[model samples]
Target chain A: MDTPDTLRYTRSHEWATDPADGVVTVGITDFAQDQLGDVVFVELPKVGTKVKAGQAIAVIESVKTASDIYAPLDGEIVAVNEVLNGEPEAINAGPYEGGWLFRIEPTDPSAWNGLLEASAYEAVAQEG
Target chain B: MQRTPLYERHRDLGARLVDFAGWDMPIQYESGINQEHLAVRQDAGVFDVSHMGELRVRGAEAMAFLRYTTLNDVGRLRVGRGHYSMLPNESGGLVDDLYVYRDADDDFLVVANAGNVDTVLDALTAHAADFAVEIVDESDRWGLLALQGPAAAVRLERVAGMELTSLRKNATRDVDIGGLHVRVARTGYTGEDGFELFTAWDDTPAVWDLLIEDGALPCGLGARDTLRLEAGFPLYGHELTSTTNPLCTPFAWVVKDKPFFGRDAMWGAPCDQRLVGLKVTGRGIPRQGYTVLDADGTSVGMVTSGTLSPLTRESIAMAWIDSSLARDGTDLAVVVRAQAVPATVTTPPFYTP
Candidate 1:
């Protein structure tokens, strides 16, 4: 329910921070984590893997379901959150900060702005 | 979809609701499934099991009718005692597994799965043509709750205003919970000492309130599933299906040697495949329909139910596989998400204490 104004989001609930030197970190939104119940395991993308926008790049496992996390923008992964392999519940505890799944070096940094803003994402989330 | 008596109560508690067997039931609460599961194992937790069905059988020939229509010797049960039994079809399979209680002389109560209530009733009624018995569908008249864990007895006593020492294992007795009276059974699906309270349909919400007020954590079906799976109990649709013979599972003892429906076919059926527990030595959860393989990578079985234990954190599953390969400690593999994960044939229950 906490939609920070500085962040951009996807309809599927991934949040992307503002481009910092053309690199933006990606993680699922708090609403996504709440809907997922409890996080038990997470499968993160590897560093240096090229991913296209809207492509399934990661997997998140709750206790009862497995969901795919999509790439918010076409980018190459620069780093992965290896700590998630042991402590996936970080996504439930701090989805926006410590639970960030990966960092991406985007082909077009401006695409981050094209995604839904916090207010628009809030509307989308309300309907969900 | 149907709604249970405590549907609104679950919503008020901010529970995540899901459709289960045509009923709007809670899957987990705000504290999450893991916490609710551990609470039941370490302390006490109550589950809204009103979605389960109940049928009452009464007549001079009720015992005889039950003896012929289902597995387990009905004669073995004394007054106010219950035992796990299976309702088998004419084929070498099961209609549903049930808990049969001899409530009184010539009167018995059968508890069944929600989705299979009609099927169970029809199966029992079909065999009642020549007997002096009447089977009544009493599902709507009761709201069931399972209070489970090590602290369950003491907690229930605090609510019932009396000691529960009179309630022995697998026994049932009528008790006064506050000003209301209900039947309390010392039986549960979880591998814990618990009581299943059968309260009046209208009184269910009050009973739930009293139990919660007494400090029993409110649990949902997700925890109920993990607990039962860890206990190695077979679910009706997953383990005992329309064509699954009970004689081949660890619950084979439930089938008595006496004659019953599907007796000949089941007894004559081959025991080539059996239900066994599997522990994933490799990564990934081995889910239902996953193929189980032997050392040579030949498909020999399929997973029925699987999960990571909330208490023990072991990736465990119940699988039906080749009887020859079902021995404990025998190495096996399960195809999980297209990867063959190393596994071992372990005996259920996967967890205790």
Candidate 2:
């Protein structure tokens, strides 16, 4: 529901924020967190691991089910959020800020064009 | 296409609705399953259980009729008391698990799962054709609500205008709730001390509204699943089904001591697999239908119900495993998304508080 204008999203619900540096911080959208309520555990890929675009990299486990977190773009994992390992509820608390899953250096910065902008992602999320 | 009386109320509360056994029902509320589950465990939570069915059996031959149709003995049930039982088929499989409440000498109430209502009713009617008993389907005409938690007694006591100490576990009584005659049963599935109120169809909305104002948080089927699983209760479709036998499901205690329907067939039907609980030590959740393996990675069984426990903060699961490996403290593994997660084969109940 809280799709920020500066963030780009994928149909699978991962959000990517491009900083001034080449690295992009990634987390699941609020809509994604809401659908998978009360996250108890998160399986994050370790730093320095190479991931392919659209591949399953992590698992977000809620009380009811476990959902896969797909890679938004092919890249090498530069950093993983250490706070999530201790408090998985952080994903439910602030999915966009404190609940950021990982950071990566994209293979190609131009690959962001294929992702949906904020407005387009919000339209897809709102479509019943 | 089927909807309960609380359909509009759930939608207004921003519930996530899904089709559960042909009934359009709410699976979770705005507060979500974890919070709702905690509310029911710590405080009071209300659930719209109108989708469940209630069948009335009455006549001079009611007791004898039940003895022929169910696995539990109705002769042992006294007035104002109830007992949990199962109905099995000739192949030693379960038809459904239900609770029988003895209202009077010739009257009994059988509460069944929502999806098995028609099947159970038809079976009962066919079994009673040559008998003197009568079976009636009262599911649509009656609406049911479950108020569960430690604070449930406090809230319901004030509304019923009676002291709550009189009712014990598995007890029932008729009371006037907001000018409507209703039946209150002191029993629940959450393993917490609670009461289930049965009222007329038209009066349910007002009662639900009043109870919500009385500090009962609205919970849906999602919370119900987590709560019951944490309590180590077996669900109908998951832990039980027509293909699953009652003896192997670890519910043989619910079977009667005397002869009844499907008793001889299920006594020693050679159950190769037994229901056991699993505790995963990894980060991934174990889900239904996941392959379970041994140390050699040989397939031993499959998971029937799995989820992250909201109370224990662990991945808990119910699995049907080889009878030889169904012992507590035995190590096993579940293949979750191509990864083998280490787990232990424990008793059926993973948690008890």
Candidate 3:
């Protein structure tokens, strides 16, 4: 429910933030974590892997169900969140800050312009 | 979707509602499944099991009729006591796993799975033509609430204003709680000391509110599943399906030595597969429909139910495997998400109270 104004979100409920030069931090939105209660395992893609926009690069397994986390834009995975391997509950506790999934170096940084803004993403979250 | 009497309470409590067997029921509360599960293990948690079906059988031939239809020895159930039993299909498989409570000399109450109620009722009706028993569906008339945990008895006793030390396990008693007529039974699916309260549909909300005020945590089906699986209780759809025989599982004791509907077929049934427990020795959670493999990685069977036990903090599962490989400590692997995770064959009941 907390969609920060500085971040861009996708229809699939993932959020991307441009926090540094050419690198975009990616994590599932607060809405996604709430819907998928009590995450037990997070399968992240390896570093240096090339991923296309909308491609499923990771899996989030909760106690009740399992779901895929899609890449927000065409990019190369620069770093993965190894902390989630041991403590996946961080996603439930702090989905926006401590629960960031991975970082990617976008092939085209302008792809962020095409994603939904925080206010627009709020509409999608509300429609659900 | 059908709603229980406590549906509004669940909504107000911020429970996550899910469709279960055509009923809109709470799957988890705000505290989450793991927390709710531990609450039942360490303290008291109450569940709105109103979705469960209740059937009443009463007549001169009630005992005889039940004996012919069910797999257990109904004759052994004295008044005020109950026993776990199953309705066997003609092919030696199960119709449903249920609890038969002897309420009176000629009356019995059967608590059945919510999803299998109609099927079980039809089965009983078809089998009752030869007997003089009358089968009445009382599911709509009663709402069941299961208050389970180590502290369940103490908490329930305080609210009911009664002494529960004399109530034996698997026994039922009619009592008045806050001027509401209630039937308290010392039986539950979770392997814990607890009581299941059956009250009239209209009185359920009041009873639930009173118990919540008495410090009972509201639990949902999600925790109910983890608790039962940790206790190694077989679920009806997963472990005792119409195609799965009970003789091949640890529940064979329910099939007594006496003759029953499927006695002849089950006498020498070829039970090549046996239900066994698996403790994950490696990474990944074993889930239902996952393939079970042997040392050579050859497919042998499939997992029926699996979960990471909150109490033990270990991943455990129940699976059906080749009888030859069902021995304790037999090396096996489960295919979880296309990876072969090492596991070992162990006895069920991963947790004890």
DockQ of each: 0.77, 0.73, 0.70
Report the error of model 3 at residue B322, Å. Answer: 1.1
Worst 10 residues of 3 chain B by lDDT: B259-268
The segments of candidate 2 whose C-alpha lies over 4 angstroms from its true place after superposition are: none
lDDT per residue for candidate 1 within B1-353, as digits (tens), equals: 99989999999999999999999999999999999999999999999999999999999999999999879889999999999999988887999999999998899999999999999999988889989999999999999999999999999999998889668999998989878988999999999999999999999999999999999999999999999999999998898899998988999999999988888889999989999999999877778888999999999999999888889888899999999998999999999767799999999998887
Residue runs of model 3 more than 4 Å from their true location after superposition: none
Task: Pick the winner on TM-score between candidates 1 and 2.
Answer: 1
Model 2, B1-353: lDDT tens digits are 79988888999999999898889998898898988988998998999999999999999999998877888888988998898888777777878889899999899999999999888888788789767998999898889999999899998987777787579899998887777788889998887889998889888888888788888999999999988887778998898988887778667777776776676778868879999889998767888899999989999999988888787788889999999998888899999889899999877566654
lDDT of 1: 0.92
- Cα lDDT tens digits, model 2, A67-99, are 899989998999999999999889989999999
Could you report the Cα RMSD, in angstroms, for every candidate shown? Answer: 1.3, 1.6, 1.2
Q: Model 2 chain B, TM?
A: 0.97
Clash pairs, candidate 1, are none
Kindly give the stretch of ten consecutive residues in candidate 2 chain B with the minimal lDDT sum: B344-353
In candidate 1, chain A reaches a TM of 0.98
What is residue B262's positional error in candidate 2, in angstroms?
Answer: 2.6
TM-score of chain B of each: 0.99, 0.97, 0.99
lDDT, model 2, position B341: 94
